[model samples]
Target: MGKVTAQTRLANQLLLEAIKNPKNLPVLSLADWELLIRMGRRTRLLGRLEADLSRIGLLAEIPSRAADHLRAARNVIDHRNTLVKWEINRILWALNGTEAPIILLKGAAYVQANLPPAHGRIFADVDLLRPEERIEEIEEKLSLRGWLKMQIDPYDDRYYRVWMHEIPPLRHRERGTEIDIHHRILPRTSRLNSDPALLFEAARPLEDSRLHVLAPADMVLHALVHLFLECDPREGLRLRDLLDVHLLFQHYGQEQSFWDGLTPRAYKLGLERPLFYGLRFALRFFDTPIPQTVRSEIKNAGPRWPMLWLMDHLVALAILPGHPDYPYPWATLARHLLYLRAHWLKMPPLMLARHLLYKAYLRSRGVRGKVDLAKLDLRQQ
Candidate 1:
């Protein structure tokens, strides 16, 4: 690991403390407030910051400048969330006659369910999951409703169709809102055996809507899998995602059934390891209230001590924001390593090597407009 300057440590620590306890925030000096806002914004947690403070009634006491930044972040999320609901309504309208079930995923799920994690959450696009057999039908319906696949390299498109969990993203012609139609939680080629059938069987419906969401435990596991297994390192580790895990755990952990069922569900989906990592980090960063018995059971799913130790360091460096002007070299190294680790976890060795070589070849040839190659769904094309 590269050296971390005291300034960086202090900055990271302050941001973390504020997240853990927003009530302590009103005491921060102006200079500290500046650091907090920058780190929160970089981590996409500024709106979350606003939400947390407001939840605890501390938002009104925050310094005016900091509060302004927080409110602005919240406003952006509010607008995006409004658009998300409208998009989903339009999606339902488009698929009115179709009998296939559609389930909201990630940000859209959190919002529609009115989960705690959705409070002030910023969304870039909407995500949906449907049965694989109905994927083509869903895509067709959306296309007729003005949603079209994003143009990309033919190879990449083939990759998505062949190996990915979702098709190439679809964007509406009029609103320009993007939607990812997924058939499963993980890629078809991924090592984890996350069966969409299991998810669909357990999904719960929304009130006054045809759409559904994963059951509570499934929701938590999906968030963790996305956090620990499916992240694009180019985007860095989102502290916001970890915060989502924290909030999900916080809300769901209130029920004994949620705790009892979580680990078993993860095992059923071949996602125990991600569940372990999610719990470990959420506990570490947010002091999430997990039951001791649940903690003991999850321990069996963790990596060995040496591997766990190494992962702790790597995750800390990659997830915690450094100074926006001077990011730590070790943090960049950690992101790249995690990027490679994600691919290793997702693909078999031979296929991974081939896919990576092809991607490297494209980059070497000055492929500027290629989608973030790290995020591809590999294909023979």
Candidate 2:
């Protein structure tokens, strides 16, 4: 492991210890408290910290400034929850006549299912998945209901319609919340496009509505795939993503069936690699409890010797916080490698080359260097 800053240390300590045992928050110096707050904000863990601290009455002991941050984060989360309910209701109303099931994904699923991870989690969009054939009708209905499609160039539009997993993001003109409509769990161009029907078959409906969430095992797989293998690799480094994995383990791992089914389900999805990496880091970082037998099985199922060794080293650098210890030269290089690795895993070389070239061309033509997830209020995984 690389040397990490005291700030990262304090922040991580708070997260791990508090999640495991909320009553046992470590005592903090003023400087440590400041760093904890800063790191929490950067890693999207402030709301989580606030929730855990309050769970055991330690929220009051935090420094005033830190408490202020916690309060602000909680306020944002509460507001987001309110907006989420409104959005869900609107979605139900829009698709009322259709029999297509509106399956919520990611943060939306966490919130809808009342999962432990959703307690203080935030979301910028509501992700909806229906069977592939229903997508066009759903999009048309949403459009009729005042959700406008995000404007993109013709090429990018075609990229999404033909190649990507989801439709162009749609934002409600009145409510201003983006909703991603997906017909599949992953991009059509991705290397591992498992039969989406498998996922659909495992979904169970939420109470009193058409909204559905993936089964416990599928939910874990989705989170693992999202964090470790899909979307932005930098996002996997976020403490909140790690914490989500921890919470999933804490909540669902209590069921012996959850453990028994995990491996087989992951293989069925063609996602054993992501699950392996997810479990590896979740255990390493948070000491997530896994049955010894299951752990042994996963170890036996994991990547081969040198590949595992390389992933351990590279992942440690890529996922750990970058800063005073692991500076830009080294830490940033790890991020670059992992970022490209995500792209390589998603698309074939020829397609990836063309995509990167076109993106570079756009950057040269004064398009932003990259879309800032934070600025866009994106809550990926």
Candidate 3:
């Protein structure tokens, strides 16, 4: 664990600021400014990452044609605004001919509610929720419009179908955008069995359409559950996700009845741990006004200390990559091994082993040209 050089720290700050407001690129640290300039000139490198970024809906603000050039240049970035506008347009289009209700989740809802329109937060995909009955019809409509079923492995597809709430991923042929159309937030394997109708019934109009956004309490709960499912304890577990909870709680401080309603729902659903962690972090880091009664209620619902500690470490590892900032290398590896063991328990033993072997083969191929493993003797360690 070595101290980050002053130069690296400045570069990190500039990177954060760039994500916050890409249009202010001129104000970045000198080192970062240099790197940006150099990257702007590297046509191949810039082209590839930009294409990947645009494919993932990260450059939605920039017109697709113009985004190609800007993503390749030193031009001050305004890509996030483009992405927000583009998502809104897409949602509007999806609603045009359909009577089915749409529920916007995660980053899209947060940006609409909290951040400035042009802030440069990156979202890899948009998630939407529709009725279980409409899943087939909606998939058909989207498929007709160039959104096709993702070509994932059969085992992974079955995993989602059986254990999860949604189908496999869908990628738009034209826009190259990916969307996860979910009927429920948590996996089916979890104890939480909230009615999809409740989400629709609670819909609020965002403009002309009666689209559903989670109630503030439910939104916070959803964010926590998402992070827990991802199992990445890092700040990078989607900084925007945590920011959404923080900003929402700040804007709408809930009362006793809110806590009363949430507690029973959470306990019954077995989401107590994720909910507790979400609330704890939101209240801890941000100035969220949680009343004492509500605090006590959540505390009682939360898991015991050891589980909390594990979650805390996982979150840390997710946000901060290396040691000192997180657990030591061996400890982190052991933790991940245990996590994989649990994940494998949900699948057939042979399927799990095959998947692991395939993953190892891919990893070895990825490193083949980059490292001389014979000299390093990786197996000795």
Candidate 4:
């Protein structure tokens, strides 16, 4: 096969976005349109991307059967509200009876916030949080209900349990859904540590029941960390996640101290880079009105500039692809290299080798791949 040019890769990304938002489709030049239309129909994935778009209100402008198929796949993954309510009840019931404080995260809390219902989102797994000590017991309980522990490699499991923040993902035999049970946010190895008890203590009751969820600030911070720090390459950062941050920030604007708290909290947790990237991108793309003090503080944290820039580009590529909205070519990757070098300088040789070995293993298992660097628009600069 011929090497895929950056232009081609970008065109593919733009086309996917166009398919999701049909209004943008017509604006594509004829050559771009041909390329997009060809690629749009080629996905082999089993999920409904169309229903997800509709659920998020992006389908109105780009209405098409193609989009509908995507939506259908999303519907397949996402449980109906009734089902979600029932599942929430099941988990809540279990937690309440056992004295385990259940802290709902992401979509579960989003739906309860009334910003949008969770039915349209593609949520194959439910994420629930409890105290760290209760994880093994909770897993045992979930096991009895036919939720099996996911059979990852033993080394991966060990790494996750020891260094990572969350347990290995669990799958339900009957429902075929997954759940990520967590006691903290960042990985233990990452040097960022938040008190799980504090998160649980700050939890408030969901609208329908006694089941509690993270406070808005905590939830936003969690989402930001997940998006930037965790670097889930497969799913990428969806527009919905950014929307959540924007909405939550707006809602909590009255709490002037919120952004102030994030600085020390992020620095203490070794999550300053992710938080900086999240806030910068949220403000830049989503028009999130970040406070001036926070912006100044981020500017002052110049050491993380390289990583933050690279992440911004990665996020833009993940979200918008090859379209005009994509960032200038090679900028992020170059900065990322600097960031990596910085880490290489500090980390002990054996520890660094171990981390690289694990990363290589993840890539070998199809977790990472070349990110189409050739498709970048290098000519613009």
Candidate 5:
């Protein structure tokens, strides 16, 4: 890993400590505040700092210019939460007309569960997990209600329908709100067999809502699975993800069975490596509460040997913020390698080869891997 700079260390220290315990933070100089806010903003976490500092009466002590950004972040977050609720209502109402189970995943799940991580989170949009049997019916229902599927090249569309875990994203006709309809957490082609029934059986519903969210243990496991799969290095997937795991641990990790249950649960789902990394980083970054037995079992569960060394260095370099003036070239390399690893692990060799060939064909024709919605002129629903 690259040498940690003063900016990176200070930012990590502040953000890490804020996650560990947000109350009674020490006052900082202007330079410190600048680095802290910038890193927080990049990770979509400035709002957490704002809310925490305000809760402890330290918000007034920061530089007014810095405070302005935090205030604005909090406002943006509040608005985002409202948008999430409206989108949730719209989705549930659309699916309410059907007999299938309506379940929220990730950010939406966190919000429905009332987990602390939901606060100050930048929700992209809602993720809905429905019965695989009902996917066509649900897609048809949403289509009739004006939710249009993304129009991509035929090859990529077939890839999603045939091998992916989720369907092509559905965007609202009037509101422009986007959602992913998922049948499982991992792609169908992945070696891991994450039975959607395991999740559906464990889902708990929100008060007076037709929607259900993952149970506490299931929620944590889903976060772990998503974290390892989505850790892109080129466009860095920030530490906000690890923070989600840590925050969820803070709330639910205290349960005596939570840590013990996570191990067997992930094993059953064929996701020991992702769970291992989640616990490892949560411990390293925030000293998250994990049982020693669980720790011992997972220590050897992650990517092994040379790959392990590579990941340790690369993950740290890529995930941590560096001094703007002295960016490390190796961090970029680490991200590229890990990004490839993520894709490689998602599918077997032959299918991956075909998938790449198809995607390459699309790119040659100017089609992006995941279609860019802005290019399609999306708007808020």
Candidate 6:
């Protein structure tokens, strides 16, 4: 990581303090509030910050400018929430005749379930998990109704169909909303084995709707996998995503059953590692209220001290939001390393090397293939 300046350190501390303890925000001067707002906006946590403050009955206590920005973010989230609901309705309408079960994933699921993570969160598209065998049928049904495949390169399309967990995202021709259909959580070639069947079995249906969402424990597990495995650190550690996990834990951790089932469920689905990393970081950043016994149980799932020590440094640099005025060279390096680590975890050594070489060859020849799609949009994912 690049050399850290005192100002940058203060910026990081201020933002973390704002999120983790909004009750103390009233003591910050106007200048610090401005910096805090900028950091929150950059990290995509302004809405979450707003929600946190409102939950604690301290929204009106912050500086007026900061409050305005937070409220504005909440307004954007409200509009997107409505669009997501409509998109979900359209999807169900398009697939009206199908017998396949549809389960909502991620942000859309959080919204429909009235879960804590949905508060002040944005949604870019709908993600649905369905039976693997029925994928083509569902694809065809949606195609007939106007949702069409995103016009990505044919090679990338084949790669997704053959190796990836989800197909290339589909965009509606008229409405321009996107949808990602998945058969499983991780890619087919991933080392970890999180079965779609198990997710389906544990899913709970939404009230007065045909749709379902992963059970509370499963939902948290899925969020962990998505955060630790699927995300590209190059874009930013997506602190907002980590905050989602924090909020989910804070909401669901109230029940003894939720805590009892979480670790066992992770072990059953081969997601224990993600659980370990998720819990570790969530506690570090937000002091998420995980039980002491649960923490001890998850310790066995982590790497040895040497590797864990290295990962602690890498994740700290890569996951934390950087100051807008001063970017760190070391943080960029950490992000690149973690980016490769993400790809390595997704595919075995030989396949990953081949994939990287092929993508590199395309880059050398000025061929823009799937690499373009790899560029992340924080608002979207």
Task: Count clashing residue pairs in model 1.
Answer: 0
Tens-digit lDDT string for candidate 4 (1-381)? 123346546665565455345445434565654555444433322232344445456555443544455556565545454465567666655555576667777766665555432434544456788788989998888776656676666777777798677898876555556678988875655545566666777788766546677875677678876654543333344555565566677777668877768777666545566577677777766567888888888775544657556555566655433333334344345345434543344344577688778878887888632222234342331
Query: Candidate 6 local accuracy as lDDT?
Result: 0.86
lDDT of 2 by residue, 75-113 (tens): 999899888878989988987899868889989888888
What order do candidates take by TM-score, descending?
Answer: 1, 6, 5, 2, 4, 3
TM per model? 0.94, 0.90, 0.65, 0.68, 0.91, 0.94
TM-score of predicted structure 4: 0.68
Score candidate 1 by lDDT: 0.86
Name the TM-score of candidate 6. Answer: 0.94
Instruction: Give the candidate number with the greatest lDDT.
Output: 1
Instruction: Give me the overall lDDT of model 2.
Output: 0.77
What is the clash count for each candidate, in the order shown?
Answer: 0, 0, 10, 16, 2, 2
For residues 2-98, could you state the per-residue lDDT of candidate 1 as single tens digits?
Answer: 3456667878889899988888999999989988888888788899889989988999898898999999999999999999999999999999988
Error of 4 at 351 (Å): 3.5
Residue 224 lDDT in candidate 1: 85
Ranking by lDDT: 1, 6, 5, 2, 4, 3
- Screening candidate 1 with a backbone cut-off below 3 angstroms (N, C-alpha, C), the clashing residue pairs are none
For each candidate in the order shown, give its overall lDDT on alpha carbons: 0.86, 0.77, 0.56, 0.60, 0.78, 0.86
Regions of model 4 farther than 4 Å from truth: 1-85, 93-96, 116-120, 232-244, 254-270, 302-320, 323-349, 358-381
| Predicted candidate 6 versus true structure: per-residue lDDT over 82-116, tens digit per residue | 99999999999999978866899999899988888
The true-versus-predicted C-alpha distance at residue 270 of model 1, in Å, is: 0.7
Superposition error at 269 for model 3 (Å): 4.7
In candidate 5, the residue pairs with backbone N, CA or C atoms under 3 Å apart (3 or more residues apart, or in different chains) clash, namely 175-380, 175-381
Best by TM-score: 1
Clashing pairs in 6: 1-330, 2-330
Q: Tens digits of per-residue lDDT for model 5 on 161-207?
A: 89898998988766778889999999987876778788898888788
> For each candidate, C-alpha RMSD in Å?
4.1, 4.5, 10.7, 9.8, 3.0, 4.1
